[model samples]
Target: MDGLLLRTNYSDITEFILVGFSRRPHVQAAFFSGLLCLYLVTFLGNSLIVIVIQRDPQLHTPMYFFLSNLSFLDICYSTSWEPYVLTQCFKNFPTISYTRCYALMTTSLFLGMTECLLLAVMAYDRFVAISNPLRYTVIMNNQVCLQMAVGTWVSAFFISIVPIVAIPANFCGHNIINHFTCEIQAMLKLVCSDTSMSLILGLVISTFTLPLPFTFILISYIRIVAAVLRIRSTEARLKAFSTCGSHLTVVTIFYGTAIYMYVKPQSKESQDQDKVISIFYGAVTPMLNPLIYTLRNKDVKGALRKLIGGKEKS
Candidate 1:
C-alpha cells in the first residue's frame, strides 16, 4: 500500500479540472444564469443586513452585533467561491491551479467553520436572553461579545488548517474534481495516497466543527424553550418564541445541509446530489437569511423601513 501510494509524484500536478455541470450549451447557460442571480441576491441581501445593523442604534445590542458578524461572514462566504463557480459554468474545461484550489478550499472551510461556531454563539446569546433576561446584557456585554467573535474566527482558522495538513500531499495525476469548487470530499477523491488517516482526521475535525457546535446549539435551544415555557403570559411566550424563530430557521437550514454534506460518507453516486445540496446551503441559504430575519423580526423590519425612508429623504 505504501509503495503504491508513493508511486505518484504530486509535484507533477499543476492544476485540477473541475467537472462542474452538464456540458450541453443550453444547460451551461441556464446554470450560469441561475448562479449569477443567486450570487447577486446573496451579496445584496447580506450587505443590506450589515448596513442596516451598523446604522441602527437600536440594533447595537449583542444579538445584532453577532448578526452583523454573521452577515459579514455570509458575504465573504458567498464571494469567495461563487465568482469562480460562475466563471467555470461556461467553460468547456474548467481548471483551477493547485495553489488556487487549496486556497479556495481552505478559505471556504474557514468561513464555514466560523459560521458553525458563530451560530452556536448566537444560540448561547438567545439562551442568555431568554433564560436570564435581567443579566443578559451584563453577561454578554460588549467586551464578551467581541471576545466571542474574535475567538470564533481564530479557532475556526486553526481548525480549518488541521484537515488541510492531515490530507495526503501526494496525488496520482487524477486531477479531475466533480464539483464546482474545491470541495474537500471531491478533492480527496483525487488523492492517490492512502487516505485512511486523512479520512479519520477529517471525521474527527468534522465532529468538532459540526456535531459539537450543533449539539451545543440544540442544548441551548432546549434550555431556551424551557425558560420560555415558564413564562406565564401568553403574549410574552409568543414574543419569546418569535425572537428565536428566525435563528432556528437559519440554523436548521444551514446545519441540516452542512451536517448532511460533511458528516456522511461520500461516494461517486452522491456527487450530483452533493452539488445540489451545496447550492442550497452555499447560495440559497445566504440569499434567504436576510429575508428570513427581516420578514420575521419586527425590529429588523422597522430598521429596514427607517433605512429606506432615510435614504429616500436624503
Candidate 2:
C-alpha cells in the first residue's frame, strides 16, 4: 500500500484544472452568456468573409486574399480556446487532459504567430500597392501571394512546435492553471522543474514573433504614408488611408493586447488582469475583425448585400 501510494505521488500528472473567470455564480453566468455570443459572432462573421472572398470575383486581388487569410486565422485562433473557455465559465475548475491542453496551446500559438506574420505581409502588400502602384500587380501576383501565405503558415507552425515539443508535460507540481485556457505561461507555472529555459525561449520567440512583426508593419505603413503624401490629390490620400485604415486598427488592437499579455512582466495583480485582457485578444478581437473589415470596406459590404439579395431572389 505504501509503495502504491509512492508510485501515485511520483507519477507525471496527466490533467490540469483550469481556474477560469470569477467563482461568483452571477459573474460566471454573465461571462458564459457574453462569450457564447462572441463565439457565435466570430464563427459566423469570419466564415462569411471567407465565403464572400471565395465567391466574389472582384475580391480576387492580393489584398483581399490576405484579408481572407486573416479572417480564417481569426476563426481558427478563436476556435482554439473559446469553446473551452465557455465551458469553464459554467463549470468550476474544470479539468483538461494534458494532451488536449497542449494541443490547444499549440493551436493558439500557431494561429497567433501566423497572424502576426500575415499582418506584416498584408502591410507589405499595401506598401507595394501604394509605393509601386505601377508594378503592384507584378509584385503581389498570385504566385507571390500564395508563397507568402504558405510561408506564413509553415513558419508559424514550426516556430510554435519548437517550444511545445521541447517542453514535456511531465509536471511534478501543482496542476492548476490560473488562466481560462491552457496558456503557455499559466501551464509553465505548474512545472516543478526550473522553467528558466522555457521562459527564455518564450521571451526570444516573442521578440521575433510579436514586436518584430509590429515593427515591420510600422515600417511598411511609414513607406506607404510617404508614397501617399507624394500624391497631389487630397481625395487620393483620403481614399488610400480609408482603404488601409481597417487593417491598421486591427493590427493596433491585436498587437496591443498580445504585447500586454505576453511581453509585460507577470505579477499576481497582472495575472488576475490577464484573464480580462485575454478576452479582448482571444474572443473580442476575432469577433470584431470581420465587422471592422466588412463595415469599413465598401466592397465587402456590397458583396454581403449581393449575397443576401441573391438568396432573397432565389
Candidate 3:
C-alpha cells in the first residue's frame, strides 16, 4: 500500500489540474450562470449590510458590530473561491499554480476558521446581553469587541498557516486536485507521502477550532434559553428568541455544510456531493446571510428603509 501510494514525482508537479466535474458544456454553462448570479447577490448583499451598519447609528451595538465583521468575512470567504470557480466554468481544464493553490487554501481556511470563532463570540455576546442585561454594555464594550474581532482573525490566520507550511512540502507526489478549489481535504488526498503528521495535525486543529467553538455556542444558547424562559411577557420572549434565532440559523447553515464537507470520510460519492455543498456554503449561504438578518431584524429593516427613503427624497 505504501509503495502504491508513492507513485508520482513531486518535483514535476508544478500545477494542479482541477477536474471539477464532468465535461458537459451545457452543465458547465448552467453552473456558470447560476453561480454568477449567486456571487453577485452575495457580494452586493453583504456589502449592503456593512454599509447599513456603518451608516446607521442605531446599529452601533455590539451585536451589529460583530454582524458587520461577519458580513466582511462573508465577502472575503465567497470571493476566495467564487471568482476562480467562475473562471474555471469556461475552461476545458481548470488549472491552478502551486503558489496560487496554497493561497486559496490559506485564505479560505483563515476566513472559515475565523467565522467559527466569530460565531462563538457572537453567541457569548448574546448571553451577556440577555442574561446580564444590566451590565451588557460594560461587558461587551468597544475594547472587548475589538479584541474579540482581532483575536479571531489573528488566531485563525496562524492556525491556517500550519497547513500551508506543511502540506506543500509533504506532497511528495501527485498534482491533480479533484475539486474546483484547493480545499484542504482535496489537497490532502493528492499527497503521495506519509500524511500521518498532516492528518493528525488537521484532526487536532479541527477538534479545537470546530467542535470547541460549537460547544461554546451550544452552551451559550442553553443559558440563553433558560434566561428567555424566565421572561414572563410573551412579546418579550418572542423578541428575545428572534435575536438569537437569526444567528442560530446562519450558524446552522454554515457549520452544517462545513462539518459535512470536512469531517466525513471521503468516498467517490461523497466527493461529488461535496461539490454541490461547496457551492451552497461558498455562494448560497453568504447571499442568504444579509437577507436572514435584515428580514428578521426590525432595526435593520427600518434602517434600510430609512436609508433608501432618504436617498430617494434627495
Candidate 4:
C-alpha cells in the first residue's frame, strides 16, 4: 500500500498543520477563556482526586481504585489536545509538528483506550456489588482490583501502538489536520496510502472498545434494577440505585457522543455537528466527569474532609 500510493517524495511531509477554529474574534476569545478554565479545573480536580485517594486509606477500595485511574486517564486524554487548543486561540493558523502529531496520536490512543477499559472495569465492579452483594468484598479484593487496573492499562498500551506504526509510515506528503488535536480519523484522512486497513482497524477497535463496555454497563444496570425491585425496603433500593446514576449518565454521554461522531459516517452537515461533539468528548467530558462522578461521591467527600482536617491540624 505504501509503495503503490507514493505520488511524490516522502520526505516532504515533515509536519502536521492544524487549522483550528475560525477567526471570529468574540468566538475565539470566548472559547479561549472557557477552555482555559476547564483545563485548569481538570488538572486540579484530577490531581486532588489522586492525592485524596492516596492519603486517605479508606479510599483504597476497588471502586475508588478504578475511579482514580479514570481521573488520571481523563487528565491525559484532555491534555492531549486541550492545551494545544487553548494555545491556538490567537494564532492565525496553528500548526502542530509531525512529531507532535504522532505524540498526540500515541497519548490520545492510549488514554482513550484506558478510559474505555476503566469504564468496563467499573461496570464489572458494579455488577459484582449489585448482583452478588453478599460476596462483593471478597470478589473485589485488593489483589483482584490491582490486576484489573493494571490489565486495563496494559491492554490499551498494546492496542494503541499499531496506529503509531501505520500513521507515521504512510502519511506520505500531506499533514494537515483540521481539528486542534491529532485525531485518529483526521490523521487517517490525511494519509496518502490506502486507508482500507486503517478504516477497518479503526472500526474494529471502536467496536471492541465501546460496545462491549457499554453492554456490560447496561447489563450491570439491568441487574441492579432487578435487585432493587426485589428489595422490600423502598429507601434502600432508591439509595442503592443512586450509586449507579452518575456512572450510567457518564457512560451514556461518553459512548453516545463517541458513536455518533465516529461510528457512523458523517455528511458535511454531520461533520460540522461532529466537531462540536468531538470538543465535548475531548475537552468537556473530562471536565464534567470529576464534577459529576467524583465530587458527588460520598467517599470522595469523606476523603476531602480528612485532607482538609490534616492540613488545618498541620
Q: Candidate 4 residues 1-314, lDDT tens each?
A: 01111122337676777765664555778778888998998888888888889888888878888888888888888877788778777877677766666677677767877787788789789778877889998999989999999999998777777544643336656666666666766666666666665566667777777777778778878887887788888877776777778778778888787766667763322134455677777777788888876655777777787788843223
The best-first sequence of candidates by lDDT reads: 1, 2, 3, 4
lDDT of 2 by residue, 1-314 (tens): 00000011335677888877645566888888989999999999999999999999998999999999998999889888888787667787789886787678777878888988898999999999999999999999999999999999999878888666665444675778887787766666566665566667778888888889999999999988889999999988998998889889989998899887788765433266777887887888889999999988878888888888743122
Candidate that scores best on lDDT:
1
Q: lDDT tens digits, residues 239-294, model 1?
A: 89998988999999998999998888755442677888888878888888888888
Question: Would you list the clashing residue pairs of candidate 3?
Answer: none
Q: Give the TM-score of candidate 1.
A: 0.93
* TM-scores for the candidates: 0.93, 0.92, 0.92, 0.89
By the lDDT metric, which is better: model 2 or model 4? 2
- RMSD for all candidates, in order, please: 3.8, 5.6, 4.0, 4.0
Give the Cα-based TM-score of candidate 4 against the true structure.
Answer: 0.89
Superposed Cα deviation of residue 117, candidate 2 (Å): 1.0
* Model with the higher lDDT, candidate 1 or 4: 1
Candidate 1 residue runs with Cα over 4 Å from true position: 1-10, 268-270, 310-314
Candidate 2 stretches with Cα past 4 Å from truth are 1-10, 168-170, 267-270, 310-314
Q: Residue 44 of candidate 1: its Cα lDDT?
A: 92
Question: To one decimal, what is the Cα RMSD in angstroms of model 2 from the true structure?
Answer: 5.6
Q: For candidate 1, what is the lDDT?
A: 0.83
Per-candidate clashes come to 0, 0, 0, 0
